[model samples]
Target chain A: MLPEENVREYYMIRDIRDTPKALDAVVKSLDGISEVAASARKFRKIFFIGCGSSYYAVLFGSWPLMKNGSVLAFALPSSELILHFSDAVNSDSLVVGVSRSGRTAETLKALEICRGKGAYTVGFTIEGGSEITGIVDEPVVLDIGEEKSIIMTKSFTAFSLSTAMFSSILSERISGEKQTLIDECKAIPSLARSLLSYEDKIAATSKRLLSENIERFIFLGSGPSYPIALEGALKVKETSYVATEGLHLLEFRHGPMATIGERLTLVISCFLGENTVHLKNFVSEFAGKGADIILISNSIDLGESTLKLPPEYSGECKALLSIIPMQILAYYYAVGKGRDPDKPRNLSRYIQRF
Target chain B: MLPEENVREYYMIRDIRDTPKALDAVVKSLDGISEVAASARKFRKIFFIGCGSSYYAVLFGSWPLMKNGSVLAFALPSSELILHFSDAVNSDSLVVGVSRSGRTAETLKALEICRGKGAYTVGFTIEGGSEITGIVDEPVVLDIGEEKSIIMTKSFTAFSLSTAMFSSILSERISGEKQTLIDECKAIPSLARSLLSYEDKIAATSKRLLSENIERFIFLGSGPSYPIALEGALKVKETSYVATEGLHLLEFRHGPMATIGERLTLVISCFLGENTVHLKNFVSEFAGKGADIILISNSIDLGESTLKLPPEYSGECKALLSIIPMQILAYYYAVGKGRDPDKPRNLSRYIQRF
Candidate 1:
């Protein structure tokens, strides 16, 4: 076990440890989320906007809205929302901004622009009375999801879980579907807590596997896990200063698989889904090519390197919990590389520049 | 100039050389594209689907539908369409599949799934009577855009142009927007022909820049050129076996800029857009960090490294023509690394597997 000083030095680990509590708090605020989802139904289009890890949070958050809700929904980076998609936002549109501090300049500017176009705006942040709340019409704050570290950990998972719950509620209301989302969300905190119990195992495995001349990492996932993969890759890239790329599971085989070799390690998020067969096939193909693979999946064993979670979890819960082991891996890999996980090179906690 | 045998050895160059003619043929098929656009109006949603270079083509193609045409549009890989977006497809959707070869199994499967959901399906390929045409309800073939090389070149540009024209025509019908798209498209073949004149220069520049231990590339763009950036990165990754990542212009500064160093070269696609100022600021920031930057834009000279295109070109024409120099760069970069451009390592002409 690591010393208390060393563990405290890795402040992101503390935030990671808080994820289960964050999930529980978010689940408790389901009524508030449902209120936001009710207003979301009035909009013709829904746009999710944020920056960096928060942008990926939007990618994970927008899925349920697009798949189950009636409105056409999209997730774009805050800068992209302002620059490339201005025409798509109109009076009938809804812009949802996701940021931990609620002070990302681009996200604030994007909300301002959307509101200027007469679009209803919503803000999701950990701060109750932040800058975003003043600019947007509605604000849903998850105070327990707040982070003490520069790198996002609990907030990303918590905000994404909240948005997933929001979209699922909207789905139930719009389509009269069974309210399966609420029951599943009720189980997520415990599931996430159970997942955190594997932290030491993940850290040990990461050190054992990555100690041998690994230079690049490829993180792959499909469906909701796709954005989780992107976030995982970014966490590694930001923390350890390693070259990492995240892609859709099947999209990797199309072209990026060419770069797979001995120096590469594949981190796959193979949640329980219809595409599990294809993911296994891809893993076997990569394994034949002498690449090391670390699979984070539910119950299904893809060999000895897999970190299996509890089986039969709902889709929403699986999406939120799949990134836990990856976050642990990134943390340990940073320590292995002898870098400060608190301050990633050449990055700021908030992008203030216009 | 290269020797005859060497030139003949590069089959991809032959395809690149045929781009102008391909553009002309696609321009001639504008009536067919208009017909497809007419049918597209019946759908509430338009989804563009493909894989790899063809998937980038879909990203390029979907822009016009989302921005100019009066419908909700999205571009996704064919695999994503089949796997994650099943709920988004219904009787009120139109799925457009783009493939250079009509034999790509995923595209056909995506169309099959879309049709199974009662969505109208349209196919675009170089093969007139191929499997995609049989699978989809409507098929439009640009026969002249067919390629003999493993990598796609002309077809990507041609199909994107046809789709841009398709969306423009749809916009014209729905909103009575002026027919500037038609006049702009008429200039594309000539512009593409003129772009080929810079092939030798691009090769020379690529060789010089890459000669000094460059291993990774970052391609950045905004608006229509964003997909161009992705396609450019894929081309280099596929052909030269070099590590390349493409990202939106503003999105890069958010985090990935932390990865910038001496070994990384920034390939920027800057067309005439409102975000020009912000892009220039980003370039300045990267330049101050001592990283190499190569800019591809229309008559906008940020520095000596900038490759200038013909001035006063419309957005659609600029988007189609911007990838010319990048394609040439990838081709010669492959040749410089002594890899066969036609037979890139760990890749195939089509992805037939699930």
Candidate 2:
């Protein structure tokens, strides 16, 4: 067994490592997921509200709903929803509140407001008895997603997968692709376990990259992978004190690409789907600008600095595994920088207020 | 008269100064505005499409459409819409393509896809007879918003204001506000002129802030102001080569707040609204983190380090004026860093392809 203090120092890694098992638990919660899916289809519009990591998770989750479930879905940060777009809440709308702690203030307030407006409210929380369970009309709790560390790791993945599962179930009911999506989701644990085997390689690459004096980090992804870039960048910033940003894959070519220089490293989440050509072009452009490039994808032999994932996971499941390498990169960088992975400076386990 | 070299050197500043007149031209084009509004209301949902500064403009513009016009609106990057969310386009949807030059490749392609889906398309462009104009069902061209420099300044403000005008007109039909929103919009040019009067002061502040050895910039805003923060950050990163990011005002507290340090400056767009208290608290917290703070707002005073916009430009018009100081700050910072603001390195006036 690892020493207790050393183990505690790597709480984030432990949480991240538990994602496969956590995902299995979420898959076994079939009854709650079905009920949640049924409640979701009842509304004309759905708003996914959360704070920080959960908000990024909403961004990733909303795509599957729009693409698969054919729903009018939106991912709005809780404060933005409550302060600016509250007028958008109506009886035809559904509010899906996401929180690991289940007591995020702005999310709770937004859920309460939506409920008051006669909108259906659903809660996706890691804690079964949290306040959100009592407030939401339909509550789906995945205790396996609960994390002891302040920064979110396992919860984001589990909740994102759960959202994809719900979306797939909704789509299968309409499209008659029975058992396919569920089968794909069940494959994630084994795929994730295989991906974890590449951690030693990622750590070595991260250490070498850190030595290059890269001053800025740009993480790019498209479609469902887009929000993973956001979550990855935020984790790196919060944990490592590095200046980081995330942008939609092709959108970077427009103007922000001007920021690329010798001091920047471009981390592209390469899914090699419909966006493969464009993503490769983005990589080439940044490479021409003299910035270091790292591609995280299922494809092997994408040249140097590539972190390879298992190639077999298809559809929504690819989105689940794509973010794993980035999480590992952020963790290694934090550890190399001598920062505590479990307790990043100036951040708490949960943000309670402004 | 200023010498030719001096004028060429600071052409961006002149463009920033021209925003008021540019806004007047958009407001004066009422026939086109009314036609666009009527067409806009015909759709069940609206997608605002653009790239780079135009995308940020779309983000700023989509707010009033949802808030006042009661439309389901989204600001999708041109590439994201074309590559990922294409399925969300339907016959009942309206696609509003916003481009400064009207030749942005992804925006044009996305518009074509939406048109193919039998969706009504609207073009908000500075160039007449451009490809977007030929494609959109309803084309509103504002030549006065055109820019000679690679960086966008006047065009973003003009198009954002034009969107506000269109949204307000739609709201008038629903709420019968009797031209109040239009009146507020017409007040923008002069208000912008008043705001530009502080350019010298803003330059001084930029000098002081840059002298502090700041390595990172975090721009913050809320509501319509939020997109301004994004655009501001992008402009600074483009022009100054400084690592920069923008986020919703209070959302900064959740996690990225950990990035705050003595080497960073927090530039916030402050508007006295329902979120004023929370925004102020965010500013104070960052201050306590030892980050330099600059507030751009219509408020009389928020103590030192605040750039005061001309008071009495009430309502959504304040959102238009709030971005000017930021543009100026980016310009001065670029010049201070000895970089050319007119032609930022590794960027073009418009993106032609991936």
Candidate 3:
């Protein structure tokens, strides 16, 4: 490998390690969350919009509002919002656009269109004075510092946590009830810090899997973990240049399970809720079909392959933590295959062109 | 091949050919659609719930209600609704459950939960007096005859047309304006019939592509065509047992574009609207990467590989028509690969368990 490749890989690993610090910074900077939540309560419909990894984060963030069945929250790709669903944004709607660079062209255009429609717009980004800050009615800028790697690792977790914090506060304000999830969100930084200690183990696991010559990867998650699965798949695809897919846990069984074979690897995030038993059964079924299974969970233990997370975190908190190991796996897999994780082929930091 | 496999393949082809007939029956049986639409006007939010192909169908069906920006319409997998988002269903919500068998376990359970929460329930099914019909308050049972094949081809199109019809009626009722799409929908059966004349051409194209030994397939669509892209991917995955993925048109550029290379084939649904130029540019970029491109469009043509649809149809109408070629492609691809499209591995007609 070239000396420059080594330097770029170091940047990716450093970004992965800096996740907890980034989350801590974002958590400490939540002064305007309640006011944003208050304004969100007035809107009948709320849209969380972003592109790529940011889209997955906003999808995770929109979960709190969706779980109560009262607020109608939709998380969409910014391009979809601008081209197709722009008619859905009206005066009674709230739009939240999340981008690490805060200058994703589709997101900026989406925010501008929503603003023109008289919808309340909020921007979430690590950059304080980027284009999105000026386009949105409210800006929740995180002072999490810059990420050197082209792939989003620290900002993904930070943005998801920030959006979840806002959604949880909004849910509480709407229901006139106190929420404990916000407190759990506060504890996520330390949890993420503790997870950083498992980097060596994750790297070893990824190297072992890479040695297997797996041709395809499938990630599955239920509920809030669904978007995490998507982010995991994207991480592997962009960094390692492998064909990977993320789907809702049961949605996999519907048709996608047919792809299970000797050269396939499955990474599943099994939540400790209603679908736990089913998730286990499905994992065993995939394993029986000769596919390798790497199960990530907070509670369920399925022998040696399960990457057990720190228990007692809520679904949202677990969602935030689950992507860390996946990000590490993507990093190591890229390095194992002699690819640079900092600069994946055919991708830029953010899409600025139409 | 076994004689039984041949018989099953025959059934699948017959079902594909019978699509127009089934769609004609569904379009003719819209007697009580206005009543359902009028009732939907009272609800603040609407959820379209289904499993597998039904899920994608309802997603296409939900586009009309989603487009006006007045009503909040969401299409979710039944398992997601029952396990994750049940709390979002309430008295002010209207839930529409769709199943070809009318006995999908998750769909039935979701309907029951929503009904218990006082949400108005509607069920779209080909099977009358099935479990879903008993569970939902309103049953829009199409008297289209049974599908002999395990894969849902005719029923998929029929259910999507029915849902789109209902959604179009609801949008009109809510906005107090006439929808030309509904009139365009009424003309779909004839269009589908006319398109079937090109089956031999579609089969030749599929066989030619299969001969290249493509390793992966990606389908991309925008607006109303997005769910069609997903359904196309599902059809290829379930029928051919190949690794296939479907995503929004621009979402492909985000990160998944890394997978574009020599053994990759892409099927894109390009509407002749705002994103046409961007879609063309992306297609050429992928083509430059040594991937085969199949452009399915109503207006735009990109040389020999473009599968042009009959012009003058609305986006919704074009979405309904685009999948026919994909269905035919999946059929021939399976047959050419010595696999039976009638019964794909690891899948049942309806998921009754969990």
Candidate 4:
């Protein structure tokens, strides 16, 4: 067992260690819940809504499904589901409301609206028998230890699996490939443990990064990796209490790249959408302007890049997994800076009223 | 005429006094000609590619047409259009490559792809026969001015009107909203001019903001206003040299909102939308978190609430008129920081790469 600080401050480290057991439980539970919807005639569209980390999880999770099918899926901030875009509620829409607590106000309001509108609502959360189960047409509750913290970790992981499983099942049914994505998910914990072995390196890198004078953090990705950059930027800022941003890499040059302040830190997730030559040229331009470049890739083109992410986590998993290291980097930097990694300065968990 | 520093530092500020009648012919007369589009009807999509300021203008200018018609319009940060997502090129598409100067690498490469794919192309640039016309369709050469010290002043304004006109004409026949929108675009400049007249108040606010420890800027809106917030944030950052970000007011709370540092200058634009309540709540949350919240509303509320906007600048002018203050704020802030408002810190008018 680890100390409380070790346990809380480094949840990803802890999660990578305990993933297998958690994955086993999450898989069976997701299967059971999804079965409820399996009997339905059809789902007109897929809508994923959640708050905080779970909300961030949806950014990447829903992408595969969207790319695969014509299913119109919207991932709204849990609050917005109730506040606006509400007329969208209907029996034809399948609402997937995610909440680690199963008790966040905005998400609960959304679930109730779902019930009122007679929509087929699916709920994924840390604990069951709360409002999520009460409102959802079929609720899958896993008693992950995520319910204990204000900052989400295991819940985000759990949320990703749910997104993957749902999309994989839909994809499986559509393509008839029948490739066992669920089985692949089972290997994630073990694979993650291998990935976590590099934790010390990432932490050390974070320390070194702290020594530098990066005024802004720019995380850039393309294709489905785009939203992952958004989440990575968000998580780091929330945890590290730093000024950070994310954008599509090449977009940097046209205008916003000017802000690659002399002390700019560029984080790249090298995937295969854009031309390699163009990326190299842009990277060189920043290098010419004195920017520190950090590449996260499965390829070795960029020397000594930070995270060596698998080119393909096979499906949506890559998108979800790609964000972890950046999140950890943020946490370590926050911890190193003696700021509360959980409660960042001058911000709140939810902005309820204007 | 405005002082040399103001116009030289920022074009948004440069145009405040309005384009001088003395420079109109100089800005409009093109010395050379280029037209590669032999046929027009077979083209399926009209793709506009530019970077930064030029691209932001594209967002605002091409919007009404995109929302109203089926002509299928898309925008790329000239870099992205060239480096990535450039595979769709073919002789069947009309690619309008835009720039203040006919030389950005990405725009140029995109044009090359258009030509290679045998697609029709057009160039909307301040300088003619520079590098870009070599690859475009009908290079509609329009020179905005010699006022160019690299920062785009006359060019962007001209680009906005030109691009809007082009897209609107293509779309109006389909949506039947062309005349109304065009009339609205015409009202925008005058409305914007009136807003610019409030330079005193705007500058005062800018000077006061200079005192705050503001490290981040967040812009929020939904529906049509969502993209406007992006444009607004870009303007502020480009002109003011401020580290600004944009989010759907509601999405902020999901996770990113957690990073709203103590020094947030929150700009909330209330465009009529389904997310109005969510927008209101987001503003309140920022206020609660000790953020300096400024509500930009055309709909006047009671005292101390909003800086009442001039009446809707006629029908179609509402959205364009609403964004003028943001441009002004960006300009003034840039001046307050003693940076070149026209040629922001490290930006270029064109990006020409392989």
Candidate 5:
């Protein structure tokens, strides 16, 4: 299927194939930590730092690192890193700094603090010799999918994709899954190519999704899907400029669901926790309330026009895939409204200086 | 001070004083959480639960509890109690449930799960004889103001005020400051009344704030002020529907400073650790960037309007006090826009079903 034919999972597939080199470069470059890998796993914990979309990637990425047997992994925004929290980073701590542009002031400051605290430091940045490069024990330059327009598209996905592969590598090193990880990661790019062939169809589906004059957007998922829900809402909020909210499927019933109606656009992430049957029921409940549903999952039970991501990616991968459609959905939604898709009205990609 | 006062800090003086029996009457008429209260004090860790505004109240209130030695505490939404994080709680855990109506479905459900797990539970509500009472070992009800508005005016403050007092009470138990707790709490109503007496002035000040037509809104405070910044943003988000954001003064330069203009409205909380001089410099930095400044604290040294609350609170109390002006700011902004303060167009105080 092509982007125009399926119109559901196209961007997701394209995103997978489109950002491979960036992902591969990051993996190969950041593999060493001595001059850059730091004091031989010297930290008690690895704190991944970023904000907004980057913060989200760190969150999802933290899961795999947790499986690496380092449960102390935490994702925090660079802003929070500098503001209230202390370097509570001991000499043994490792701070993995992440930024697409490599210029976000807080990330630079955080790297400075990590080094100042005599802790291990490493960074993933798009630009080499940027301020971030000078502050690291090892700096991995990943200039993947650099975007000229402000709102992050290719860069965000590439960064997250690279983090995923990195997590797999870490998981392999610590959890004894080396062979499987190597095999899987090697297959990812080709798999991504297969997915991209459906871009035309996903694009068509996205156009249909934007046809409704939706004033309210509610996105739902569970487990790892939780972060995807947040990202989905963020994409819509920053790009489409809509009143969007993201919450776990069941959590919506807690209080936010009271605002649901025909005017609302409800997006559900299907590749969720082990037991998504209840989530399916939760989606049905929304349907009962006259809300439209957009399902993105590896499973087909999510109803018609579902974006069936390849089976190789489930669980957290399902969550990763969820990001693609929402990105395209927002991109298409923005252009349809005669608004610029590249540079949203009140937002910037780098958030420089302020 | 009257509602129209330009003075800041409206403690629940008049309202609480008008209903002296609120503490005892409400406590006795409802149910007492004597058993849970007694047992909860012995937990290794405690978790507070609620939804939306109520959920945020627990987050803001938890810091004092943390400082007092319940260092492993977490404030979670009731809806999340059993879904994604049921593993976090068990028979050994202590749980506090907070809700304005006392009957929030998710809160009740969460309480049921807690009791089912044999975890000790305390239920705080504005009314009695509901699911919360049925599920909790002890239920504390304070029906002080029957908040009629859907947007939750008096109820939000009442919850924050009562929770602060409760935390102070618990803090006293931990640090043997019971007498001080009672004395301090007893003094709040008068402080609130005195502040309320200046209501007319605040309303006038708020009128000017709304008229400023500031292009951006930035709130600053340290420590507990971080949560006040969150609450302030939540209020503004729900009310005037503006793109308002809050950050600690320390992190003000992260990225938000780039968009500063005279049209920017900078609300600075000046109580304890206010960093007023730094804040003035901050405002000057923004003014240099052409951003306007609005000051709110126990005191303000220069420029813009000063929301001067009497220095009767610190730590969490400062947070409790700091919220007053922002609430007024949101309320007046809503009123100025001719939007109903009680009922915003696309929102609900609670979402009863999925």
Candidate 6:
């Protein structure tokens, strides 16, 4: 048996490193994803639902369908869906519930409510025989192994990839044309492997942040990358108990920019979309305000602080890759702060109570 | 000429105190709101778009339509709509743009995009001659006077009330029955005045929080009240430059509960809905963790920390009233922190740049 200290030291980082394998496992399960997509294509509206990290994953996954504009796709928190939005579900709607543990009370209940409303329900999870698999009409269970740590690392990536694949396949089925997003997704597993090689640099950055006495973090992203920013902030908050907030790049300027100071670190997920110039200008303007900047992008390196991803990935694929550096940062930040990433206070693997 | 100190002293509190008058003005403009609702009822989908505080207002305003479940109603950040979700807009859609100043660049651009896509567009704003009024097909200009302070208080309430009224009228048009929400809203001006009478109590609570050296705040709400939580958090950040976050009440238990500690204040916007028990249990559990609890509710008061609201209002109307205490709290918190709420750093009356 592994010693307690050894298990604690390795659990979170091991899950972080296993993300590439998780992506590969999801790639291998494309046939299962396609089956869900086939069922999804018949619906006029799709609701992607989950809780916590899974909610962020579904948000990332729903981007392709949202951008395609052929059908209405809404990403909602499961509790919100169950409590307020269940009435929106009907026979013509498809509800996709994602839960890493497949036992999130709100998500399972949300799926039940949607089913009661006569909507097509699909469950995405790593657990094959969990409560979600039984409740959902169709369950796309990923083969990715479980994480020893409570903090989601590989499972988040795998669930996000699976949902993105589902969206891509569904988009293809609707348009009767092949999607390049599927092809772009195929490159992620290898790209994610390369991202993990920057652990030392990420650790050094974390050390530098600790040395600077950074009091809080603000993550910013645009379009498909917005969910990544949210998940990044959640990751840091859960792992290190940091005071962090995530916002749409432009939304930050609206009010949150008031919190900008030398003690604040801005982690931006940058995409080479129409708003690239605006994002660049925003970074420079905030940098001038004494805030530390860390740009995670597939294109346009702003400065030495930028964490560059493989330039080939774009759109939703780049959004998927953007979370890798954030995961690594959260890990090292927790370690630097002498906190156990494997056991965050006041949280569990899945919320059982409402 | 008035002294600088006098201007600084009155600007924010004066705006907060003017909320009742703004509600009265919006109530008097029911005819204009009805005209916009008449146009909105013809659409199958409704998109409520805004930026910052206006964004939160639109969210609160979109609740009645969202709850009715006849038409698809989405509340989105204007920047997100312009950069990503614009494709969802079509000829059968109604896009309502809300901006206090009617000159927020993103909201104006989003309205233009919706118009170009052949969708009907309506502008809701305080400024009659602003750019949005010129760009949108219809403008429901509120007669609520300009805010003396840069931080939105009266304008937020006025905009939220106008939108809520629009949603209620649209719902009544679709259902061919009178909506109780509108009748409930008619009582808001007086209810708001009564709420303002609790200013001394709110100020004492703010003083207690400051004395305790509360490092940060997390505001929580559910259903329609979620936007109020977001707006409350934003108001504090904008006014006091504090590290704050807002989450759906249940979403807080997911990952953010990890941040619960002695210096943390959980400001919950509680409602007497299906999840009332859940909200009560959540507050007690967190209180056990040594976190300060501030419950804002209409029907329930768990302890001394609970800020009671008038019990008659329910649903959307109750949600609108929930923000008054938060606005007052934000104002006093800023003043207690030795910061001028009227002169928040790195902010302007309206964001002109993208």
lDDT against the true structure, each candidate:
0.80, 0.79, 0.83, 0.62, 0.60, 0.85
Chain A only: TM-score per candidate: 0.94, 0.91, 0.94, 0.84, 0.83, 0.94
Q: How far is candidate 3 from the true structure (C-alpha RMSD, Å)?
A: 3.0
- DockQ scores of all models, one per candidate: 0.55, 0.61, 0.66, 0.30, 0.15, 0.67
Model 1 lDDT per residue over B47-127, tens place = 888888888887887776666524677888888888878777899888889988898988999899999999988899998
- Whose lDDT is greatest here? 6
The residue-by-residue lDDT of candidate 2 on B1-354, one tens digit each, is 124225345678878888888987987897778877775546667788899889888787776666652456778899888887787788878888898888898899999999999888988999989889999998889959558789899998988888777766766775555746677777778788888778778877877877876758888887878889999999898888888888888788788888765278888887755556556666777777876788887653456788765557546557767789899888988887788898888888787874
TM-scores for candidates 1 onward, in order:
0.95, 0.94, 0.94, 0.78, 0.72, 0.95
lDDT string, candidate 5, B47-73, tens digits: 788876777677665655644432345
Residues A11-108, candidate 4: write the lDDT tens digits. Answer: 44455345445655776676575685474446665678887667766755675554443344567677656655566567776788887767777788
Q: After superposition, how far is residue A258 of candidate 6 from its true place, in Å?
A: 1.4
Between 1 and 5, whose lDDT is larger?
A: 1
Per-prediction RMSD in angstroms? Answer: 2.3, 3.0, 3.0, 5.7, 6.8, 3.1
Give the runs in model 6 whose Cα sits over 4 Å from its true position.
A1-8, A175-178, B1-8, B175-178
Which residue pairs overlap in candidate 6's backbone?
A: none
Docking class of 4: acceptable
The digit string of per-residue lDDT tens for model 6 on B1-354 reads 124334245598888888999999999999878876665538877899999999999999988887776667888899888777777789988999998888898898899999999999999988989898899999989998889888889999999988999999888887677889888889989888888888878887898899989868999888888999999999998888878988888888889989886267889888645556666776777777777789888766767788877666555577778788999899888887888888889899998977
DockQ of 4: 0.30
- The segments of candidate 3 whose C-alpha lies over 4 angstroms from its true place after superposition are A1-8, A38-41, A274-279, A288-290, B1-9, B38-41, B272-279, B288-290
A195 in model 2: Cα distance from truth in Å?
1.1
**Cα interface RMSD of each candidate:** 2.2, 2.2, 1.7, 4.6, 6.3, 1.8
Judge candidate 5 at residue A9 and give its lDDT: 31
Q: After superposition, how far is residue B9 of candidate 6 from its true place, in Å?
A: 2.9
Residue range A1-354, candidate 3, lDDT tens digits: 234335344688888899999988878877677676675547788899999999999999988887865766889999999887787788989999998899998899999999999999999998988999988888988988899988999999999999999998888878778977788888899888988887777777876787888768888988888999999999998888777888888898788877765377888888645456666776677767776788788766666667887556544556668899899888888888888888788788888886
